[model samples]
Target: MEKYIQEDLDKKIILLTGPRQTGKTTLSKMLNPDYDYFNFDNPDDRLGLQEKSWDRSKKLVIFNELHKLKNWKSWLKGVYDTEGIPPSILVTGSAKLDTYRKVGDSLAGRFFQFRLHPLDLKEIHNFLNPGNLEAELDKLLFSGGFPEPFLNGTTRFYNRWKKSHLDIILKQDLIDLENVQQIIQIETLIQLLKHRVGSPISYASLSQDLQCSDKTVKRWLMILENMYIIFKVPPFHKNIARAIQKAPKFYFYDTGQVIGEQGIKLENTVACAIQKEIHFREDCFGETKKLFYLRNKDKKEIDFCTTSGDDPVLMVEVKWKDNSLSSNFEVFRKFFPQLKMVQVVKELKKEKTFPNGAEIRTAHNWLSTLTLP
Candidate 1:
């Protein structure tokens, strides 16, 4: 991501957005030493931005939390339109800048957006080259993929860090960006989502639990998504509207936030890794890939499905240790015979491919080298 981001910065404005503390600011500073950084949260920095007083001699100008500015898009457009990319413009934010709406002009063709996710199995293995992937996987599942806690490699530290992390994102970031005031309800929503991993989320169920309306629950979920606290995977259907109308599954960006058995955590981990891959393809390569789960009215389901444009291209099922093929695969096979099917198990003695061309893979090995179809 650093390499790709650097290459894109020279040609176009790089809008880097991700979960807070995923190292967006750290990575941006590392890109160049002689860079001027202004954060909108800081009062002095906000003044500087309003006055347009950043050092022009710097190689890069990073406006952290730029989305908070009123009509930020118009301001940034004026900057780019008047002064081209000599001092490269890099906007970093914790919220989704593209989705963050403000009353401003469109920045359609002037910028390239990159969503930075937490370190995944493949990223950690590639960078750190851990000899014991199973141990690393355990640590990742326990500590999560955030830079600080994952590198600390301690459950005690992550336990303490998790609370503060959510507090800041929910109390500070969420309130500031979304203007959402139901802090306690949103926290409960997070806890509710933790248990509901790998299952379709019913807005009515959640609303009932939170003592709110279904519309309020849906809005809160969207707010959580924009803040990168959770991501939803809608059920795959040929009709896009129907797919959205159906119950969709949600997973946390931080794996440690999930509360469940190892099987459920493993499913969340796989979902995160698969989502990271999909985001990479879309961000870096400009591919139109989407993440979804497979389910029907009969409750027959496959864990995940990836599609390119509108065509379903791949199906993935996750299991704890069951090596036997999923009968659900055959159910979906009848409709899309050419789709690639794979079942990844955490504890597999041998990798095998059934006669139907569906493959069973070791979860750790596959996730460490996961690539999109």
Candidate 2:
């Protein structure tokens, strides 16, 4: 990511956004030691931005939390159009920076965006090179992929950190980004969703449980999505509009936030991993890849699917201990034989492949080497 980010910094403004503690600031600073830094949350830095008073001699200038500025897109456009890029510009934010990219034509082609996510199997394998991948997987499942908690590797620290993490995002970030007066209700919604991971969410059901209208429930879900608290995976259907109208499954950005059985956690973790992989291709290679789940009216379901444009590429089923092949694989194969199918098992004694090209693979090994077509 650093290599690709560096390459883009030379030619365009780099907009890096992600969850609150996904190491955006740390990664930005590491890119250049002598870079000038400004935070919109700081009074002094805010004043400096208003005055355009940063040192231009530095090779890199990093603007932290710049999205908080009113009319920031026009402001940045003016800066880029007039001053040009001797000192490369890198903007970092916690919220979805791309959401505001469509506000106006102010920043049409001046920036390249990158979304940073929590650590996953492939990243741990590449960077940490863990001697025991299975143990690292255990740590990721238990403490989550956040830098601090995962590194601490202690139950007590994770518990304490988890409380403060939610408080800051819900109490501080939410208040800053939105005007919703129902913080408690939003928190309750998160709890309700935690237990329903890997299942389609019915807006009617959610509204009834929260004593709110369906429209309000949908608005709250969008708010949560923009804040990077959760992501939704819609069902796979050839008709795009019809697919969107169907109920979508939700998963948390933080795996530790899930409250359910081990199988649920494993599914959520795999979802995150696939999402990260998709984002990587879109960001670095300009590929058209998306994530989805397969379900029909008959209740036959597969855990995940990846598509290139409108064509399905891969189908995956996640299991904690069951090594037996999923019957749904054969069902889907009959329809889309060109798509690769695999059953990822956490406790498989041996990996095998069927004559039809479907496979049963060990979860840790397969995930560590996961890549898109």
Candidate 3:
């Protein structure tokens, strides 16, 4: 698979991070075919690398999940400072390396972080023929983008993959990377979070339920976020202090992982597809753009807020039904008269412009147009 970060690998100490089984290792192999590979999961390999010092003269060295080790950052600093500049270094981990407690006072400003999300329309197009968007959406929503599950296309295989991935992360990754003692509590917390995907996370409530402190809950959530397991989307409120604050909506970095763990629902699927389209458009435009959801004091909400600089370029509302516009859109339209476009996905079969001058387009057509210039 073609990665968005491959071109920038050599120039920076690229930190390739994502949820388990998103193909970080595969991408690393493709990027550095001649490099020496070491995986911390392997006992011998971990010991060897830990025992010996890093030599800068080597062609390339790829460290996989080394952040699990307590001295990983210190060891890396020693290698980086002593080694020559010609040789390249690559590190891959399922969890966030920077979140590691041991990564202190070393490797500052030396690495660039890149997140690899689940298979999106852009990546699917690159891998296979960009034939029909509807069919592609069906495949992506049901089969999901994980390599093994998507390739096998069987319920049994997908179930096994989900089970094994969760077990490994809970049994191995967390234990190795974090000194997590209450394994059951963490597992329960993850399952609970999965159910509350698009809702604002309540750390205090979660802590109370888990019989832990608020700070402990926050720390665990951070660990999950850094591990690429989940992400939070902040509300877009400019000059509106009354807007919803303090809590942020949570989302899985890979919608597929969420679907596999939880059951696939139409609303969730459509939301994921729309989110993917918004992100792709931003990436293609090469502008500092962002995706946000809006909610006001009156409980009026917009599904997506796409912006360039301080200006609101577009406001998108996604729905699974056709020809449906909420009263919320009218409220939003009144707030910002200049916001002329509102996209309703899965609802409209064809692109249609409202009499009020807002252009309503199909999700597929809109996403296809987002290509790198």
Task: Give each model a TM-score.
Answer: 0.98, 0.98, 0.83
Model 2 Cα lDDT, one tens digit per residue, 1-373: 9999988887999999988888999999998887999999899999999999999999899999887787788889889999999799999998888675535456878899999999999999999899998888888778779888988889999999988998988898788777678999999999999999999999999999999999999999998999998999999999988998999999998999999999889899899999999998899888999999999788999999999987998999999998678999888887788999989888889999998888998889988999877
Listed per candidate, the RMSD to the true structure in angstroms reads 1.0, 1.2, 3.8
Candidate 1: residue 271 lDDT (0-100): 92
In lDDT terms, which candidate is top? 1
Please write out the lDDT profile of model 1 over residues 212-261, one tens digit for every residue. 99999989999989999899999999887887789999999999998998
Which regions of candidate 1 are displaced past 4 Å?
none
lDDT of 2 at 53: 93
Q: Candidate 3 clashing pairs?
A: 321-347
Question: Given candidate 3, what's the lDDT at residue 26?
Answer: 84
**Superposition error at 328 for model 1 (Å):** 1.0
Against the correct fold, how does model 1 do in TM-score?
0.98
Give the alpha carbon lDDT tens digit for every residue of 1-373 in model 3.
Answer: 2344555556657677777898888888887566777888888887778675445556567888878767788777776676624467888889877777484556776666665556765566656766787666655666566777876767788877777877887888777777688789988888878677666678788998899998898888877777666666667878656334456666665455553332223334544545555554444334566556777777677766666676666776665555655667677777677775665565466677777766666655554443321
Pairs in steric clash, model 2: none
The local distance difference test score of model 1 is: 0.91
Clashing pairs in 1: none
